[model samples]
Structures are given as structure tokens and as C-alpha cells.
Target: MRNGKTIEEKIFKILTGVACYSLIAILGYIIFIIFRKGFSYLTIEMITQLPTGGYYYGGEGGVLNAIAGSLYIAGGATLIALILGVPAALYINSHLIRHKKTQNTVRYILDSLWGIPSIVYGAFGFTLMIWLGMSASLMAGIITVAFLITPIVIRSFDEVLSTIPKGLHEASLALGSTRSQTAFKVLLKQGFSGLITAVLLAFGRGIGDAASVLFTAGYTDLIPTNLDEPAATLPLSIFFQLSSPIPAVRERAYAAAAILTIIVLIISLSARFFAKRYSKSNLK
Candidate 1:
């Protein structure tokens, strides 16, 4: 019996290690390919200048418009998600704390929403745009992306808040603090790092999701100055560039992909740093 148990444990451990290493290898391969193909073409001109006339056909231009548009839409969407998600998460962890059934139901619904395909969100946003007499513009994209990421924000923050000791809640209430105050002041502080991670994750998702923004954010060559103007994103830029027959255009697509990858990497790193720092501070 002891020998059998040891063998079983060893097998599972080996399997887990294999799985972990496989994922890391795959990720390393992807990063290697993107950079190897893109580094040569990713020039200062590509990053700084707007696409020139006939730019898609190996013209002199950059993807600055796409970069700026992506930042604007993702940043706006993230801000909106943060504003809405934080309060909702706080409410769930505070008011609904005692009601396990209700809390679970809400979380299940959020998880379902999060799992829904981004294309579905695009279709829904398109429908909503027509009904509201809105065109495909930056505002439309921001709104659509916000809707897509809100559930993620809420669920991520809720999970964090849930992990906190219930004694903190009880203690705050015992000290004569209102539920609202306790939820915001005590719980929000405890879960601050998680909140940052959730927002950055949503931002990364919003920026990288071409499907969700394809219908809502109409393509544009120039950077949009207003919310009502059409915007371009890096994912769309890469898609369009890759579709071109020109080899240079294809190379540019890889470069755009590299840029997108780097942005997400930065967001991920920042999240880890902030989360770790704040977690330590909270502990202290």
C-alpha cells in the first residue's frame, strides 16, 4: 500500500512538472518568434510616423495612430470598468457576505459573462449602436469594451475581497462604522492590489481584443481627436497588415504584434510589482 501511494504521488508530480514546463516552452517559443520576425522591421519610423499615402503597399509610415487609439480606448474602458466594478464587488463582499447562495449566483453569472466570446459582444454592441443612433467610433468601442471587461473586473476583485478574513468585517461594524464605510475603507484597502491586477488585466484584454472592437471602432488612418471619431487599434492594424500581399506589410504586421505583446507584458509586470508591494504593505 505504501509503495502504491508513493508511485501515485511520483506520477502526478512528474505530470504536473511536464505540464508546467510545456506551457513555459510554448510561451517562450511565441515570444521568440514574434521578436525574431519583428525586431528588424520595428523601426523608429514605424513607431513614430503615421502611415503615408499608399502605406499598406510598402509606403513610408508608422502605426502611431493605432497605438494612440488603442491606448485611448483601453484606458477609457478600464477607467469605466474600475469605477463600476469596485463598488459592485464591494457590495457583493459586504452586503451579500452572509448570503452564500446569492453571492455564488452572482459570481456564476459574472463568470458566464466573462466566458462569453468577444465576438458576441461586438454583435451586441453593433445592435445597441444602431438602436442608439451611434456610429462606429471611439466612444462606441470604449463602451463595448467596458461592457466586456466589467464582469472580469467585478469577479476578480470579488475573489480577492472574499479571501479577506470575515473578522475584519465584524470588527469594523463593532467599531460603529457603517456597512458602506467599512466596505470601502476596510475591505477596499485590503484588496487594493487585487483591484489593480483586475483593472490591468481588463485593460490588456480590451486592447488586444480585435473582435470586440472591429464592429464598434471603425478603422481610421489618422489618430482620433474626439470620442465620436473612428479609431484604429493594434490588433486591427496587425490583421490588416497581415492580409496584405506585400512582404513588407506582412513584416509590419509582425511588428505590430510584437508591440501589442510588449504592452501586455508591461501591464502584467506592473500588476505583479504593484500587487506584491501593496500585499507586503497590507501585511505590515
Candidate 2:
């Protein structure tokens, strides 16, 4: 019996290690490929200048418009998601804390939404845009991406808030504090790191998702100055460029992919740093 148990443990441990290393190896290979193919083409000109008339045909222009547009759309979407998600998450963990069934139902629905394909959101956004007599533009993309990521924000924050001790809530109420006060003053502070992490995760998702913005963003070569103007994004830029028959254009697609990967890496690192800092501060 003892020997069997030891063999089982060893097998599981080996499997887990294999799985972990496999993921790491895959990620490393992806990064390697992107940089290896893109580093030569990822010039300052590509970062600074807008696409020339023949840019897609291996012309002398950069993807600055796409970069700026991606930032604008993702930033706006994240802001909207944060505004809506935080309150919903707080309500679930605070106001509905006692109603396990309701909380589970809400979370299940959110999880289902999260599993839906980005392309579906894009299609729905396109339909809604036509219904509202709105053209595909930065505003439409922002709204669509916001809808895609809000469930993620709510669920991530709710999971963090749920980990908190219920005793704290009871104690606060016992001390004559209102539920609202306890939620904002105590729970919010305790879960600050998680909130930041959730927001950053949602931002990363919004920025990287091409399918969700494909129809709604309506690509343009120029940076959009208004919400009503069409926008370009890195993912879409990569998609279009990679589809080109020109070898140069294909290489530039890899470069664009590299840029997108770097942005996501930055967001991920920022999340970790902020989460750690706030967690330590909360401890102090």
C-alpha cells in the first residue's frame, strides 16, 4: 500500500512538471519566433510614420496609427469595464453575500459569457451599430470590447473579494458600521490588489482581442481624433499584413505581432508589480 501511494504521488508530480515545462517551452518558442522574424523589420520608421500609399505593398510607412488606435480603444474600453464591473462585483460579494444560490447563478452566467467567442461579440456589435444608425468607429469598438471584458473584470474581482473572511463583515456590522461603509472602507482596501489585477487583465484582453473589434473598429490609416472616426489596431494590422502576398508585408506582420506581445507583457508585469506592492501595503 505504501509503495503504491508513493508511485502514485511520483507519477502525478512528474506529470505536473511536464505540463508546466511544456507551457513554458511553448511560450518561449512563440516569443523566439516573433522576435527572430520581426527584429530586422521592426524599425523606428515602422513605429513612427503612418502607412504610405503603398504601405501594404511593402511601402515606406509605419504602424503608428494602429498602435495609437489600439491604445485608445483598449484604454477606453477598460475604463468603461472598470466603471461597470467594480460596482457589480461589489454588489455580489457585499449585498448578495448571503444568497449563495443567486451568487452562483450570476457567476455561472458570467462564466458562460466569458466563454463565448470574440467573433460573436463582433457580430453582435456590428448588428447593434446598424440598429442604432452608428457607423463602425472608435466608439463602437470601445463599447464592443467593453462588453467582452466586463464579465472578466467582475468575476476576477469577485473571486478575490470572496476569499476574504466573512468575520470581517460581521464585525464591521457589529461595530455599528453600515454595510456600504464596510464594503467600501474595509473590503475594498483589502482587495485593492485584486482589483488592480482584474482591471489590468481586462485591459490586456481588450487590447489583444482582434475578433471582438474586427467589424466594429473599421480600420483606418490615420489616427482617429474623434470617437466617431474609424480606428486601427495591432491585431488587425497583423492580420491584414500577414494576408498580403508580399514577403516584406508578411515580415512586417510578425513585427506588429511582436509589438502586440510586448504590450501584453508590459500589462502582465504591471499587474504583478501592483498586486505585490498593494498586498504588502495592506499587510503593513
Candidate 3:
């Protein structure tokens, strides 16, 4: 009986190991394919040149304008999200909301926004921007992306905030720190690692997002010389060019896709670095 039980345990361990290895192998294979097919088009031209007339024109004239627009929009949204979402997360997690009904209502709104489709967000942004007389503009794209990313940041930050121990808050009070200081100085400082992760996650999503900003942030391909002007992003440019009938146009699209992939990879790696630095520094 003892030998039989030991054999059963070994079998279970082996199966678990095989399952984990298989999952990792599958993911690695997919990434390999993507890199093989999509990386060759990443060129200096693809990074610097603007899109023109359904074709990517000139060497070293890649997606610079699109990349700039994407950064600007994502940055603007991230700034706005931090201003509102972080404090809200702190307030809610710290139980500063005395009214149960109001807190519940606000939580529901954030959660519901997460469930809404990305296309709907774009459509709504276009309608709102046009009604405001801006049409398809960079600011419109920023606001639309901001709205989509805000709920995610709020959710992530709230979870991080919740992890702060009750003992920490109580100790802060014992040291004569007021409620505000306890939250802002004590809780936030301690939760900094998680907050950094939240920001990075939101940024990654914002930069990669295509559908929600497409209609509002009209693809103009020209450099975004002014806030009120229409401009193309890498993702939007890829979409428009990919639909073209010409082979050169499609090649340009492929190149743009490769560049976009590189941009996303950069952002993701940066996020990991940030998370690691903050986590290690704060852990001590």
C-alpha cells in the first residue's frame, strides 16, 4: 500500500510538471512566430517617416509621427487617471466613504465601464468630440483613452491599497498622524510598488489600444503639429494601410505592424523594470 501511494504521488507531480512545461512551450512558440514574421519591417524609416497616400514612403520615414501621437495621448490619459483614480482608490480602500450607498454606486460605475466594449468607447468619444466641435483630434483621442484606462487603474490601485495592513494605519494614528497624513504619507508610500505597477499596466493598455481611439483620433499620417489637428498612430496607420489593394501598401502595413510590436515590447519591458525597482527598493 505504501509503495502504491508513493507511485501515485510521483505520477501527480510528473503530470503537473508536464502541464506547466506545455503551457510555456505553447506561449514561446507563438512569440517566436510573431517575431519571425513581424520584426523585419522595423526600420529607422518606419520609426521616423510619416505615412503618405496609402503607402509608406521613403527610407527611414516610418512611424515617427504615429509613435509621437501615441505617446502624447497615452501620457495625457495616464496623468488624468493618476490625478483622479489614485485618490479615489485610497479614499475607498481606507473606508473614508461614510455613505455605503454612494460608495457602492461609484464602485458599480467603474466596474460597469470595464464591461463596455472598446468600439463603444470610440464611438462615444467621436460623438462627444464632434459635438464639442473638435471633430477627430488628438485631444479627443487622449480623453477617450483616458476614460478606458481610468477604471483599470482604479481597480488595480484599489487592490494594492487594500493590501496595506490595518496595523500600519493604527500605528500612524498612534504617532499623531491625522487621517489625511496616514493615507497620503503612510499608506501611499507603503503601497508605492503596487501603484507603479498600476500606472504601467494602464500605460501598456493605452499604448496598444487601437479600436477605442481610431474614430476619435482620425488617422492623418501627418505629424501632430498642433493639439487640434488630426494625426495617425502606428496602430491606426497599420489598419488603414492594411486595407489597401496595393502590394507596396500592404508591405508598409506589415512594416508598421512590426514597429508597433517593438513599441509595445519597449513599454512592457519598461513596466517590468519599474515594478522590479520599486518592489525591491520598498521591500527593505
Candidate 4:
């Protein structure tokens, strides 16, 4: 039996190592290709200047419009997701804890929503836009992306809050604190770092998604100055550029992918830094 267990352990270890190395190899390859092709075409003007007339035909222009529009959509969506997700998570944990059936049902629904494809959300947003008589614009994109990430935020925050011991809740209430007070002051404090993580995760999801915004945020050359105007996004921008017949235009696509990758990397690093600092302070 001992020998059999040893064999199983060795097998598992080998599989785990293989999986880990496979993932790293794939990630490294992607980064290498993006940087190698992208760096050659990358220029300060490519990021700072807006696309000029006939820009896709190897013309002098940049992706400023896509960058600004992506930020606007992602920022707006993250704000909306935070506003909705936190309250929903709090409600599930603080208000509905005793109602196991209801809580489970809510969780099941959220999990199901989370599994739904981004393209479905995009299609839904398109139909909703038609119903509301609104044009494809930044606001539409924001709303769609917000819906896309709301379930993710709520589920992540819920998981974090679930890790807090029940004893803490009982003790807070035992000390004559009202439920609402305990929830806001005690639970929120304990889960603050996790809340930040949830928000960042949702923000990353919102910013990275392409299918959800494809129909809603109509492509445009100009930076959107209002809610009604069409906006471009980095994913779509890369998609368009990469599809170009010209080699230089295709190279610009790699540059756009590199910029998007950098933005996501920065956000991820910042999240880790803030989470670590908050964790330390909480420990103290």
C-alpha cells in the first residue's frame, strides 16, 4: 500500500509540474511574440496621437482614441460594478444568512450568470439599445461591460466575506451592536482588502473583454467627448489593425496588443501592492 501511494504521489507531482511549465511556456511565448513584433513598430506617436485620415494604410497616426475610449468604458463599468456588487454581496451575507435556500438560490443564479458568454451579453445589450432608442456609444459599452462583470464581483466578494468567522459576527452583535452597524463597521473592515481585490478583478474583466463591447461601443476614429458618440477599444482596434493588408498596419496591431498588455500588468501589480499593504495593516 505504501508503495502504491508513493507511485500515485510521484505521478501527481509529475503532472502538476508539467501543467505549470506548460502554462509558463505558453505565456512566455505570447509575451515574446508580442514584444518582438510590437517593439519594432512602437513609437511615442503611436500611443499619443489620434488616427489621421487613411491611417490603416500605413499612414501617420496613433491609437490615442482607442486608449481613451477603453479607459472611459472600463472605468465607468468598474464603478457601476462596485456600486452594485458590494451591496449585493452584503445583502447575501448580512441579510440573508439565515435563509439558506434563498442564499443558495441567489448564488446559483449568479454562478449561472457568470457562466454566460460575453457575446450573449453583447447581443442582449444590442437588443436593449434598440429598445431604448439609444445609439451604440460609450454609455452603452459601459452598461454592457458593467453587467458582464457584476456577477464576478459579487461572487468574489461573497467568497471573501464567507471566510470571516461566524464568531466575529456573534461577538459584534453580542456587544450590543446592531446588525447594520456590525455589517458596515466590522465586516466591511475585515473584508476591505478582499473588496479591493474584487473591484480590481472586475475592472480587469471589464477592461479586457472584447465581445461584450463589440456591438455596443461602435468603432470610431475620434475620441468620444459625450455619451452619445461612438468609441473604439483596444481589443477592437487590434482586431482591425491585425486584419489590415499592409504589413506596417499589422505591426501596429501588435503594438496595440502590447499597450493593452502593459496596462493590465500595471493594474495587476498595483492590486497586489495595495492588497499586501492592507493585509499588513490588518494584521497589525
Candidate 5:
């Protein structure tokens, strides 16, 4: 053997490390940019004030409305995604699809949908909602987010359920259980951690999405008076604010981005909390 390794080994190692370090560096740049700009908007008044004139008038206040809209719309989408994706994943994983052809077709379709651009999804929702006269309504944004989340949710759920021991599924069937009953009582119980991860993934995705909601969820200075009305979400507001040429708007965008990061971190951490506990108990 030539000394230690071939050139390919060294190349591969270098490439992998460079790829990983590149990602870390990019993330570091983002964090630094957000914090450096965001601190400018950290004042009590600035945090509370609504978009106003160049001076930021004393009374018009806070991103409380945007925050609420984000939570409501994103939460609604996750609910819809879970309802659709979980059942679909369960059916697919339960071997109920029967035909390999049909299963592959569905899986391929889902995989393709996952690759669709978020802005395209937003435009689609906007057009569809406007056509249906539900423009700027909560329903529009909810549906858009649902569309974005469904593929990811289905994939995650399928992975988890697929990873479950096939023996358990077969044993349940052998003991006179129906597909639904077996999945509900045994496979689901076992795959609960993965289901949780899927949920976290969905929540994280929904909360971070902006393009999908940009047109669907119309920007409103006032909070939504009813579900039929338009609302401003954190991400959309951030996008709009960031696009402005003003330094203040840019700073506000950075703060909103940091806030978005924090929210995602919390949701991920909570999901992992249950996972860690489940692992410990299973180990014991």
C-alpha cells in the first residue's frame, strides 16, 4: 500500500470538511448579520411601535399582531398537514396500498411536490384564493402552508413508520387485528417519537415560511378582525420590512429574523425533549 491512503481518500476528506465548514460559515454570517443589525431595533419603543413615518411615531405599536398571525396561521397549517399526511403515511406504510406501482407513483408525486418552490406555492395560493374570493383571508394562508408542509410531513411519518419492526406489524395481523387497529395500537405507539419529530419538522417549516404566505396573507397594519380578513405575519412583515431601503426597516427585519430563529429553536428543542425522554425510558 502507498503511504497511509490514496489521493482520492484525502480529496474526499477535504471536500466533506470543506462542505461542512462552508455551511457553518454561512450560518455564522447570517447570525452575525442579524444580531449586528437587530440590536439597533432593540429599544422598548422600537420593539413596540407599529410601522410609522421616518420618526416612528409615539403611539402606533408593536409586532404583537404579526406574532399572533404567524402563530395562528402556522398552527392551522400544521393541523391540516397532520390530518392529511399522517393518514396518508399510515396507509402507505400499513401495506394497504397493495400495488407497488400505485405506491411508487404516489411517493414520486409527493417527492416532486416537496421540490416545488415556496414562492410558486405562494403564487398558486394567491391566485386560487383570489379566484375563490377568499383573497387575503386566513383560509388562503392556511391552505398554502398546508400544501407546503404536507409532503415533508408525509415523508417524515413514512420514514418513522417504515423503520418500525416489520415483525411487530406481522404479529399484530397474525393475532386477528385489522390494519387500522394494528397501526393505532402497536406501530403508532412504537413510532410515536418519529411522529413527534415529524410534527416538529412540520411546525418548524410552517413557522419559517414567508413566500407561501406573502400574497395569501395580506399585510395589515391592524390585527385581523375576523378570519375572513387579511393579517400580517412575522415572516411576511419581515420580508416587506427588509425590502425597504431605509436602515430602520432593515434593522426591524433583522430583529424579526432573530425572533423567528428563536421560535424555531424552541419548537425543535421541545420536540427533542420528548425524544430524549422516550429514548431513556426505552433504554431502561
Candidate 6:
């Protein structure tokens, strides 16, 4: 029996290792392919210039418009999500701490929402816009993306808050602090680094989601100057370019993907660095 158990353990370990290496291999292959196929097209001018007339048809122009537009939508969406999500998360942890059933219900709902396909959100947003007599605009896209990421942000932060020692909460309350005050002063402070990481993760999701913004953020050749204007995003930009029959335009698609990958990697690393810094400072 001991030998059988040992064999089972070894088998599980082997499976886990295989899974981990497989994931790394897949990711590495994807990155290598994108860089290999697109490196030559990733010129400074390609990033710095906006699309001119017939740019999609092998004309002169860069992806500056898409880059700026993506930043605008992602940033706006993340801000909105933070505004709504953090409070909800705090309430669930602090106000509903005793109501495990209710808290579970809320979390289940959030998980369900997070599991919903991005295209569903896009369609819902599209329908709402039609009902309100609104056009496809950056604001619409931002709202859709915000809806997509809010659940993620809330759930993520809630997990972080859950990890805090109950002693902290009890101590804060014993010191005559109100629940709200304790939540903001003690709980939030303790979880700030994790919350930032949550925000960054949500921001990455918002930035990468193409289906959610497909119908809301209309494709534009120029940077959106206002919230109500049409915009473009990197995912959609890559999708559009890849759909082109022209070889050069297809190559540009790979370049766009590479840019998107780089942006996500940079932001993730920056989030990790800041999280570490904040965690250390908070500990002190």
C-alpha cells in the first residue's frame, strides 16, 4: 500500500510538471512566432505615426492612433471599475462578514459575470446603446470594458482582504473604530498592494479584450479626441490587419500583436515592482 501511494504521488508530480512546462512552452512558442514574423515591421515610425489614407492598404502610417485609443479606453474602464469595485469588495468583507450566505451569493454572481463571454457584454452594450439612441463611441466601449473587469477587480481584492488576520479587524474595532473607518484605515491599508495588483490584472484584461469592444468602440484611423468619439484598440487593430488579403498588411498584424504583448508584459512587471515596494513600505 505504501509503494502504491508513493507511485501515485510520483505520478501526480510528473503530471504537474508536465502541465507547467507545457504552458511555458506554449507561451514561449507564441511569443517567438510573433517576434519572428513581426520584428522587421516593428519600426519606430510604425509606432509613432498615425494611419494615413489607404494605410490599411499598404500605405504610409503608424499605429499611433490605435495605441492612444487603446490606452484611453483601458484607462477609463479601469478607473470606472476601481470606483465601483473597491467599495463593493470592502462592503462584502467588512459589512457582510457575518452573512456568509449573502457574501457567497455575491461572489458567485461575480464569478458568473466574470465567466460570461466578452462578446456577450459587447452585445449587451450594443443593445443598450440602441435603446438609448447612442452611437458606437469610446464612452460606450469604456462602459462595456468596465463592466467586464469590475467583477474581476472586486473578487480579486476581496480575496486579498480575506487573507488579512482577523486579529487586525478585532483590534481596530476594540480601539473604538467604526466599521467604515476600520475598513478604510486598517483593511484597505493592509490590502493596498494586493488591490493594486488586482487593478493591474483587470486593466490588462480590459486592454486585451477585443470582443467586448468590438461593437462599441468603432474602428477609427485617428486618435479619439473625446469620449464620445469612435476609437480603436490593439486587439481589434490586429484582427483587422490580419483579415486583410495583402501580405504586408498581414505582417503588420503580427507586429501589432507583438506590440500588444510587450505592453501587457511591461505593465505586469511594473505592477509587480510597485506591489513589492508598497508591500514593504506598508510592513514598515
Task: Give me the candidate number with maximum TM-score.
Answer: 1
What are the RMSD figures for all models against the true structure? 2.5, 2.8, 3.7, 2.7, 3.3, 2.7
Model 6 spans > 4 angstroms off: 1-23, 274-284
Q: Write the per-residue lDDT of candidate 1 for residues 148-170, one digit (tens) a residue.
A: 99998999888778888899899
Per-model TM against the reference: 0.92, 0.90, 0.82, 0.89, 0.84, 0.90
Q: Model 2, stretches more than 4 Å misplaced?
A: 1-24
Per-prediction tally of clashes:
0, 0, 7, 0, 1, 0
Off by over 4 Å in 3: 1-26, 52-60, 97-109, 277-279
Model 3: lDDT of residue 167: 80
Q: What is the C-alpha lDDT of each candidate?
A: 0.92, 0.91, 0.78, 0.89, 0.79, 0.90
Candidate 3 residues 1-284, lDDT tens each?
99999999999999999999999999999777667666665566667666545444332356677888888888888988898888888887665535668667777887888788888889899889979988788889988988889898898777667666678878888999877878889878988878888898888788878998988888765778777887677778778768877766667677777767767788778767766766566532
Least accurate 10 contiguous residues by lDDT in model 2:
275-284
Candidate 2 per-residue C-alpha lDDT over 126-223 given as tens digits, one digit per residue, 9 for 90 to 100: 99999999999999999999999999999988888898889888888899998788888888888889999999999999999999899999999999
Cand. 4 Cα-lDDT:
0.89
Global lDDT of model 5: 0.79
Error of 4 at 70 (Å): 0.5
Which scores greater on TM-score, model 1 or model 3?
1
lDDT of 6 at 240: 94
lDDT for residue 114 in candidate 2, whole number 0-100 = 95
Residue 52, model 2: Cα distance from true site in angstroms: 1.7
lDDT, ranked from best to worst:
1, 2, 6, 4, 5, 3
